[model samples]
Target chain A: MGGTAEAAGGAGAPARRRQARGQKRIEEILRAAAEVFGEQGYDATTTNAIAARAGISPGSLYQFFANKDDVARALAERYAARLATLRAELDTVARDGRDLDELVAAVLDPLVAFNLAHPGFKALFARTDMPAGLREAVAPVHAAIHGRVAELVGQLLPGRPADEVARVATVSIQLVRGMIPLITGAAGEREREVMTGELHVVVVSYLRRQTAGAGEPGRA
Target chain B: MGGTAEAAGGAGAPARRRQARGQKRIEEILRAAAEVFGEQGYDATTTNAIAARAGISPGSLYQFFANKDDVARALAERYAARLATLRAELDTVARDGRDLDELVAAVLDPLVAFNLAHPGFKALFARTDMPAGLREAVAPVHAAIHGRVAELVGQLLPGRPADEVARVATVSIQLVRGMIPLITGAAGEREREVMTGELHVVVVSYLRRQTAGAGEPGRA
Candidate 1:
């Protein structure tokens, strides 16, 4: 599907140049939109401010998006696509037969990489007012990654139910998400490494028990 | 510090009346501020809007707060105080004799209850721009609760390190905080029960792990 767009662009030089320019303009608009939304929030952010930041006119913005909401949806879609690529890349990095520590590291490293690479975009993606479709689209990818982590937990602790495994997986992911902004800021390098190491030990010890047959009783 | 304020107010009837009125006005301002801040956000929400919401002139708003930042700080302080009270209540209700599930419920239930009772306050509390002092005040209370939960986890799983247990406790608390807003409407009853029940299950299961041997290998 992406290949078709590239192929069509290659067929006509002038058309391709115009298309490339439009794409660049859209990217610029999205970048400006993310900053505005992050700083001022979704409802208060205006198309005019976004246009001013992008060094474009409102009419140019309208040519690409219907309005602010449309721009938000588009931005969210782009972010979700980026996250999907990261998820796939992380999956491709084989976890089989690795220690649980390494498997957990594999699951978390790509996410940290994404956060470091796109801190502003990460903040925007975490915003509450994100479009419903974007939330729906990202939910399954989250669930799939969580499922894989749960399977790893299951292997480490074969006595636990699949549900319990998944619950721990979800908690681990939520913690990392909470820590992203904190880790990125003035906590210092040593602080982040310590927090990460602490989190690792937490997961390992929690899992070791169910495999040992002394697991706490789970809620029905 | 609190005793000093109480002593000052206790010295005379006029002082007591003035203090009561001042506290009432502050509450009104906070209520108005929450609505404005939630609707318009921190950067865009105006002191005038907050004053108007409270049926007062902009000058009257300045009597209590120096500016919008002061107003935000006051709101955050009130919220942190409320959260502290809620944590205290949870600690009072929780008994060590209770099983892990009950213990978890006792720890989380009061927080959910407070949010259910004050939905607007919950929304305001969730806002990222909460004042630094308020955040700092909440941290020790959070740490206290986290430490208590960590001790419980250690009891349930005898061999886990205190540091590791504390990390899981922190993770669980963070999860509950993030999940509450997603699953509950600003103040709706139906969503409240659903969110609480969902949280109950997650906490119960996450604590009950599969691999429990001392210094067990990290491999799944």
Candidate 2:
């Protein structure tokens, strides 16, 4: 029995190595796709361009993605997963009794970092013509973010109607979404930081107005 | 010469009437297209659907428009002309010495009214997939609006750097653009008004903070 197990492990080693290589190749393709899509936008990007960017043959690209849309959908799923993780982290911050400015920073910093890290995420998800399947893949995550924002709003404005809380949350989300392109498109890190500060000011000012005299006694 | 002119006019009456009828038909088609586009969105809509919505035949629709993109371009042109007029009016309001809230209202109310009147305008222009020609048709007006806002921001923050003024202006426009969908999509006139009010608050608060010490001493 021990001899048979050893033989099986030896046989699986090459297969495991192949599987790891396949995973690495997929990540490389997606990284290349993100760069291309960010530069050329969704409509202008092509699988051939992505393959070239990936340093792979078009045939190799086809092994993983049927088309640019498939690449975009995969990217959307990746963004959604990352956003979900960020949301959980935000959930912790929201309940940590931080003041409005701290809370706003906690939320915006990671998001801006994520957008800066993945330059293609906004270009892919921001399009109104995003493929329906891709939108579906991202929609749940977006809804969750909205829900989480609303929950935070409710906490800050303790007695506000749910509808009002939701409305403020929706506007807040849109406000951040609207500013993201500006932040991400800033020419350099310094400019991006400035834009991010502006966003923080805009959001904090608005939330301060909305949550005034409503939350805990000492919360800003 | 007077008698000859009168005779020409008499003969040209039928031709003039035919031109007028054609103009009216074009207007009807555009109006229907706007409604249909607003209802069904840009991608889902077809020339055939526009024709049906206009109570005209497909052939008749094509007589005026080469395709749905042409119809959207025409609509974009129409919207541009209207926005140009609105911008001129806003120029008057911006210099009228209104307080921050009043100025915010002046800018937002008319723009909101224009959006409400033309439900299809946002639907058409908000799309990232908007046809290139259609975007070209509307691009000038959008730039003009941005410039106008920047000019206003410069006035409010007298000594701010040009870049800062432009940045504020860009963010302000995006802030309003972000809220328009919420305002337009509100369930009723009352709800829409509430959303509009909320938007006004957000913009005014942000501007108040930005222009805190740089503007005229007596200004808000």
Candidate 3:
């Protein structure tokens, strides 16, 4: 939610009605923002265009957002919230004590799906020129996701040294994150299918090497 | 060489001397372009800045490159030629009938070194907004490298189908290419070394799985 919407509460019944409407309008604005930002690069997207797409006046848009950069930061916050929800689900998967491939698939499947569903993800984060503040705002969430994965690897491989588990987790995350440009953005249907399946093989192989170092491994 | 430099050869001694200077100037300009492009980014870089880094007048720079885009395309071409030379070395490794790890080491070692030596390799090609012409000029070289790796995989696995070899090759390249940002840019020294070794394991394990299918297999 934007600042204005959050500020709209704490008065009478009529004031409460206005606050509800303001919050609804903010949701509409964020929806439209995703469309415009994803359809065009971030630099090409404009606040006026976002306002227009939301079917709200410029003043109404301004009531919620200071400008385009504000819109981007708000959107990033929205995305971060969604990722937090997914990570809760991922926690359950990590605790399931499954094989390495099963655990990885549980993590990557929803992640790639979430990325595809949210266009602003690739549009904002993939851009070389996305604002420094916006990147900073999102970095902690990204690191937290990596940290959780590292801890899961630690649990799954009890005898391994802590440092090696940390390294495995880092590169494992990198391997998946590295594929996003192809997976969510540029890849076509056939290429998508191939890369998605291959991503599992790549992730599992890397993980097994870590756990079974100098020893024979089990199934995928 | 720029159009003007090519034309200079049709004249006499002065023309030959000018052509030599023009070629030298082009190399100097390219080196400077790489530094600026890697240090900042493509859109932020200007021909004037590249010229200044090269310690040449703007007029001299323009005599070779028509504009900034022109300069990027030329650098991409130069990068392509270097890749061609590396592929020939890779071809020899494939023919030598070495172990899987040995062959993969021969290929990835030099490729990673090349990427580290030229930061512009990632800065230019990895960009979301790289010009279509520059990308097209580089695409063939990239495809050729993938092709050679596919063929090498085919020779290494005598009974593997060509298509399986091809698929493994595609993902292997993607895995390595995907890691380039972490490998050459963001990752620290310890992470870099860990990734470099882990990359070999990832490649070799994936390759082993492809050849052996669901069964246990020999080591890479």
Fnat: each model in turn: 0.07, 0.43, 0.31
Candidate 2, residue A15: how far the Cα is off, in Å: 20
Top candidate by lDDT: 2
Better of 2 and 3 by TM-score: 3
Models 1 onward score TM values of 0.61, 0.74, 0.81
Any residue pairs clashing in model 3, and if so which? none
Q: Return the DockQ of model 2.
A: 0.27
Candidate 2: docking tier: acceptable
The interface root-mean-square deviations, each candidate in sequence, come to 5.9, 7.1, 6.8
lDDT of 3 at B113: 90
List model 3 lDDT by residue over B97-157, tens digit each: 7777788888888988998999877766755534455566457556767787788778877
Please give the distance, in angstroms, between residue B198's alpha carbon in candidate 2 and its true position after superposition: 2.0
Candidate 2 per-residue lDDT over residues A128-191, each given as its tens digit: 4444555665575578678888987887888888888898898888888778877887899878
DockQ of 1: 0.14
Worst 10 residues of 1 chain B by lDDT: B1-10
Question: Candidate 1: interface RMSD in Å?
Answer: 5.9
Those runs of model 1 whose alpha carbons end farther than 4 Å from true positions after fitting are: A1-19, A28-72, A87-106, A129-176, A194-220, B1-23, B34-49, B86-97, B127-172, B186-194, B201-220
Residue-level lDDT tens digits of model 3 in A1-220: 3532333335642323447887888789888988987787575677788889999988888877656666776777788778778877877888887777788888888877887899777676654433455566456556766687888788777887777777678777767766666666545876676667777777887777767764422122
Itemize residue pairs with steric clashes in candidate 1. A207-B211, A208-B211, A208-B212, A209-B211, A209-B212, A210-B209, A210-B210, A210-B211, A211-B210, A211-B211
lDDT of 1 by residue, A25-89 (tens): 88898888877765665545678999999999988887666556567656666766777676554
